[model samples]
Target: MPPSTISRVINATNGRDGELVTSQQCIDHIRTQRVNNIGHECISIIRHFQSMTANDKFGLPFAPFTGVNHHRQSTLLGCALLADEQEDTFVWLFKEWLKCMHGIEPDAIITDQDRAMCNAIHSVFPTTRHRYCYWHMQKHIIDHLPTLVSRYGEQFQRYWGLWCNSSSIEQCEGYWVEMKEKFDINEEGDGWLQTVYKCREHWVPCYLKDSFFAGMRSSQRSESINAFFDGYVNSQTQLHEFVTQYKKVVTHRRLSEAHEDFKSLNTKSVMLLGHPIEIQAGEMYTRNMFDVFHTEFKGFGTEFCEELRKDIVEYKVCKFTDRGKWEVVTYE
Candidate 1:
């Protein structure tokens, strides 16, 4: 039998000692018996880093991971060991984590619109800009107002496009007013729109366009991390099994990233647009990023100037279609 199976049997049989049956007992056994030296090693590493002169200006940076769901009965997944999704708990976690890092805070954080999480973030990292996950926001809008999408499909698409792509606060405000009037959202007493509007600073791109968010407008990366972990371990995984599996997962991920990096450094991407700009981008960017740039570069040729004013220029940008339908917009 595998070591994991043997360990599971031992845990189930109270380990022949009759003291490691409960979740707490299992946790204590793992912490004290297995990883006690590892915990001490981590503290020693932290202390060594702190003592180094080169590290004086830089603090130990870490990312927050929350809402990790696992089976309640599993020893490794129990609430007593893992942090709960509560405001006070989150605040305490942040405080304890920050204490080790010498008070350095993250510039921005992207999360779902959980009131407790948002409140905890604000309380602990007051200066950090909190952004709502765009994917989550869109899902909420669709889920809450299914009729809007079903009945006014075209109008909703237009509204969504305008809301996402608006470059400035003025433009967003103008588009929002038009959207509300055309949809009769205000007159219909749409509570969802009202609530979202009240927290516009957290989600609206116009308000956050100038903030340095490292180009992140969603918590999709965090979700992807969770998904990666799901491939290695499930809810029923024991504490020791989880630790062993986690190391394997991390090793696999690191190897994959290293492979991608080697490929990026060694290989050259084929130019799509055959333009000088595209050639430059192909040299500078990774294969995936060059593809995105090539797509945008191709669209630039399709746009034409319709009208030019002293302060504003009107451009008709063509959509990707055989028919010559264009979107006209004024830029000042």
Candidate 2:
């Protein structure tokens, strides 16, 4: 998250030593400094090093992280302002964020495929699951392989979608082969496809389904949070005025969150399924999560249930296509 704000004076006092450094070791040394009053919610970041573009109006050191609250609304989870997009700078930023969070780490962190940010995440929070933004990945594919997209648009999406929607790791691997052959691309070559494919575990959905991302599998949510201040501050926003405006931004966002909480508590979503599982899920989850569960469950229809083995009496419930879904239950 790019720590953002109104005035240079505000962002200048992040911690001790002012983190002044020239060498890598010295850069690492200042990372120990405690960040000042950045504020918090839970976990997630705003504008995480996407393309590393600088600006005179916005997007400097202020790194805002967004998270989902109990009301299932996006909430701010603290932030930091950095001097640059260097790997060390990000490491220091992440370290400061960790301190701000009381040394607690998120279960999963999603961001754009910035190599520097990715490396910093691995160095600072190795145990956390880092997912690449599929939105960014798609943009990158079009940017890197314009010819492939323009020429083989439909066919490419067919294989690409299949690969992305694979139900298991083995199936994902098989689809990868088919995709490569469909395009007649070489696996050993150092092209865009080959390079991105090497890091499949990071971007692939089938590889990430087991992780509890709370339905946020991409960094797209962060994109909206990044724009949370668009109306408040613009390209010409002065450093000093930004401080006052930022307070309004925070207050407005908090008020919006409270409004969402009020609505969530007062309303009831229409029960689409009325099934016991759906009913139970509605009782347990917030409106947004229950809606997600309802949509997924609606796609689940058991075409048949057959006994796989009489000894264990394992019954497998699956759809005719199997591509839709497959569920197995064992009765002993």
lDDT of 1: 0.67
The number of the candidate with the highest TM-score is 2
Name the top lDDT candidate: 2
Put down candidate 1 lDDT per residue, 38-151, tens digits, no spaces.
658878888876665442322222233532211111011111233456788778777775676579776777888988879998999999888999999989877866665776
Question: Deviation in angstroms for 150 in model 2?
Answer: 9.9
* Each model's Cα RMSD: 14.5, 17.8
As a whole number from 0 to 100, the lDDT of residue 207 in candidate 2 is 91
Q: What is the lDDT of residue 179 in candidate 1?
A: 82
CA lDDT scores, all candidates in order: 0.67, 0.73
User: How do the predictions measure up, each by TM-score?
Assistant: 0.58, 0.67
